[model samples]
Target chain A: MNKQPEKYQVFEKENEILRHSKDVLASPELLSAQAWQQEYERLAQSYAQLLGEVKLLTSVSDRLQNKLNKANENIARKNEELTQTLEMLTRERIGKRATTIVLILAAFFFIVSELVIDPQLQQSAKIFGASGLIVLKVTVAIALKPIEMILENLLLKTAVRKKMS
Target chain B: MENFFLEETSKTPKLSFDVSTGKFLMSGRSIPENSIEFYKPLFEWLDEYVKKPCPKTTFDIKLEYFNTSSSKCLVEIFRRLEKIKDAEIVINWFYEEDDEDMQESGEDFRELIDIPIVMHMIAN
Candidate 1:
């Protein structure tokens, strides 16, 4: 009868030993961490490659932006130059119109001097009148350039003042 | 199908799509003020070409410069070309040897489509 109880205790202890062995097998140590490490490394490599590709694309975009900026600067410079040239040409045109008007008025004066004033002059008057007429022609011819220059300079100053305002 | 030839202009490129040889060429600069209007005829011709495409079609692109709108149109053209099946489609991309941007642009297009693209560097 004492042998029977001892045998049952031994059997139950053997069963408990088997259950403990099963628990050991199911522990976290059986799982390989290296698999997760390898997957992490693979994802890291792909992330690096994507970063490099994005960097290259960003570099290309910056280069193109630099080229576009240079082109815009060139266009602005050319446009400014064209505007200045046009302004100068317009001033010169106005000066030329003034010259034409002055020339026409001088012609009228010459005609009046010749038709009315010249016939009324005596020999003495003729001498002085002729000299005065000659002087008038010379003055008109000499004043043409200075007049145009003055008019253009005035227009330029006015343009400058308007721009400043 | 009849051949399509458009002369190059200051704001456009030269396009010669020969139906007989199936050798399509687009050269020069493409920066038109009106992209849709300028490329309408080309799209029309491509529409007709897709209906009766050549057996072995090829595209040769040699451009010095192109704008954003032109690039989009070019992508659309490639998309249309992609629809053609059972025929070989080869695209040759030409660029200056010193032009890295053009080569990358070709690479970008290659990534976008399935057709084969070959880059040719023109020596100065």
Candidate 2:
């Protein structure tokens, strides 16, 4: 890893201390115990500063890890939900199928009654009058969607019975 | 039976299931009030197609949104395709970048179906 700028500053300070070694060791009288104690204190302070920076970086790293964990957890939860939803959908076609069967069958029944069954009945009742055709048309119109829905329910019941067997 | 093709609408997806090249595709929104009714023709066509399938059938699916009812129909479509024994059924599910829901939906579908499904991410 690349050296941090603060670490580089510490290295420069150490190099400066090495350069002044002659002064430091030359005369104990000029550079006495008091001066030596001051040099020791400066090095100690630098070490403490470096320790603080390390602690800060480690804390930031920990926070990022926590965020990553939370994101992963959210994704896992969503996946579970999706699985459950898919299973439900895969099993739900019967209900929709019943509705579709009704719609198409209803349309078919309507057309047959109007064009086939009703006309035949109308022809048989021609002696009564053309009013029979009008009545048949009215009844077919009133029962169109409802009768289809009823037939659809019947079909659904039969399907359920078959499946149970 | 002739190949099926239904144009996309605001409430439904575009459906084009051809037989010549064996390319089945459905794209866009699918929120029809009666999804089963809308998909009835597709099922009828597939029933015929599976009888004499092509070497490789690629089903491309790209849906921006779909309702719960449509989900069931889609499942039915996949189940129908699963009956084919010869043709290689490949499903390609496409989604825009950062669309996690769509991607996961595709994942869910692939898990339930026997066919191979590949997910593709496009630019958002």
Q: Which digits, one per residue and each the tens of the lDDT, describe model 2 over residues B8-124?
A: 999999999888888989999987877667787787788898999989899999987776556656766886899989668899999889766677677777766778999999885
**Model 2 misses residue A73 by how many Å?**
24
lDDT of each: 0.74, 0.73
Cα error, residue A12 of model 1, in Å, equals 61
Could you tell me which residue pairs clash in candidate 1?
A: none
TM-score of chain B of 1: 0.96
The chain B TM-scores of all candidates, as shown, are: 0.96, 0.97
Candidate 2 residue lDDT tens string, A29-75: 67667888997687676566445434533443444455468779999
Q: Per-residue CA lDDT of candidate 1, range A1-165, in tens?
A: 124342233133234544545554567475478855664575566556445444544554565676689789999999999998988787777677767766776688779867876566545455677777667558867886786677667766777788789
Clashes of each: 0, 0
Candidate 2 contains a number of clashing pairs equal to: 0
The segments of candidate 1 whose C-alpha lies over 4 angstroms from its true place after superposition are A1-35, A116-137, A151-165, B1-91, B96-100, B103-117, B122-124
